[model samples]
Target: MQVITSESVFSGHPDKVCDQISDTILDAILEQDKKARVAVETAIKDDFVFIFGEVTTTAKVDYKEVAINKLKEIGYDEPFNVLEKISKQSPDIALGVDSTESHEQGAGDQGIMFGYACNETKELMPLPIMLANQISKEMDNARKEKYSHIFGPDGKCQVSVEYEKGKPKKVKTIVVSAQTKSWINRELYEDIIINEVLTKVLDDKAIREAEILINPTGEFVIGGPYADSGLTGRKIIVDTYGGYAKHGGGAFSGKDVSKVDRSGAYYARYVAKAVVRANLADRCEVQLGYVIGISNPVSIHINTFNTGVISDEAIQGLVSKIFDFRPSMIRKELLLDEVKYQDLAKYGHCGREDLNVAWESVDLKAKQLRKLYEETKRASQVL
Candidate 1:
């Protein structure tokens, strides 16, 4: 059987905890000064959290309190040490991003950003990651409310989907491990995760049957940062497609929109989703390259994975017209400067439907692509 696996962790997971703290600080800074140039990273370990990165914001922020409050919000009430070593954005790097001769705002750094979309899931995301993320969110809700007594704030869910002829057929197995206050009955815990979390999250059509395992170690009383250290950008795979597509190797969290790594990735998603939503392709992936000190992308690439109704070349031409990959244009189109990123620190960043994330919107671009595809098709037939 052909099987693909993907996993997602709760917001209280060590890495995610760091992600939220970093983004929380970002949101605070943005709320005050929309033009803040912040690129904060966090590292969390047992009883301590370290915050370090470059900041060039005029806004006044209490870094330590931001870290402590974010940890507390994630249900960790312990007294942990907080360290800060943040500095201003380097002049060398700033020289590129600051407006200059020919461009409005140059890229924050030189890097490539990738975006992908598929019809395998309603969110246009790959089935394995979507299922994994949904289950993680479900379990997180249970921990917050009904099952708080049994489940701790830290947990992870993994789904192994069996594919038949390149299409997802059924779930092969599901593995879930949750942190708890004490060792509970294995059977009961397993049953709750299967019935309450997995069953509710997975659509019946997506998974006919599967093996479910919970807390394989038989206990998980120790978890969160106390169990392991977590650093920002470490969970890039989880933050994106769960290895279903190629990543440009850039992390999204803890960075401002000026960082092409964040904004460029978001813009690429906007473009890819537009293609899928326009019905130009059943799946699409967009890749963009930006160089420091350039307002426009150095290169843009698109692949329909042989699923495009129109030719991939035509789609590429159309995408260029519909979307702008320039760092300044991306910031303007997505309103990135005003976005509150803390809400996107968990579950997954790409297919978020609960928040007012602008990247998820594709109506305007979809219509434009659809119209162009039809026009091109008719013109080609006449030829």
Candidate 2:
């Protein structure tokens, strides 16, 4: 059997903590100035959290308060220091993107963005990552509610699924490493993690005979930033498809909607999901590339992985007709500036159905493209 592994961590994880902090600041800025240009980076080690990045906004904010509040919400109560080095964006880089008399707003930066979808799960997400995310969410809930004093804030979940002929057939194993303030017996901890966390999230049939490993390294009493360092944009894989799909090597956190790394990726997902929802393909992956000072994408590619009813080129042609990859157009269509990104900091961003995110909307543009193709084929056959 071919085994694929995917992992996810709670919001309290070191990298996730940094992600939340950065996005918290971003959301606060966006709440006041929707057109703010923000690209914040955060790093936490021990009791000190360092914040540094570029910002050009009309919004006034207390950066320290935002960071501390995020920490407290994540269940970290220890005294901490916060340092700030935020400043306005560079005019050289902004010149091309700023509105001008000759050109529309150009891309914020040059980079590629990727989007993916598959029939493996209801959310069109890969199964292993979905299972990993579900387990992580459940673990976070336990820490927040009934077991606040018992379970620690930082934790990780990894799931291995066996695939047969490109389909997930069974769960091979599950690994959970949760932090706590006290030591609990192995048997008891494993039981709680299994019954309370894993079993509740994983598919019953897939995990029927799966092996579970909990805190395999004996104890995890020390975790969070106290145990390790965390930096923003460090969990890109977990933020997207958990390694199941190709990435354009861009991170989503700590940036405003103007950055194509964040907004373009969202638009790609919007287009790919429309393709899958239209039944043109059982799976789809869309890639987009852009250059600063340009309004349109420099490159566009689509791969259905041989699962499309038509050729990849055909799908690409249809996608180009249905979706606009220009930077300004993406921001406008996806309503990126209006979104609050803090909630997207924890869970994987692509397949989120819990939030009314615009990118998750299932549009029928691809379906219309398919209908047009069918009609053309019928007309040609009549000739």
lDDT of each: 0.88, 0.88
- In candidate 2, position 239 carries an lDDT of 93
List TM-score per model, in order: 0.96, 0.97
For model 2, the stretches where C-alpha displacement exceeds 4 angstroms are none
| Global Cα lDDT for candidate 2 | 0.88
lDDT, candidate 1, equals: 0.88
lDDT of 2 by residue, 246-352 (tens): 89988989899778999999988888888887788898999999999788998999999999988989878777777788888888888787778999999789889
Tell me each candidate's RMSD, in Å, in order: 1.5, 1.4
TM-score of 2: 0.97
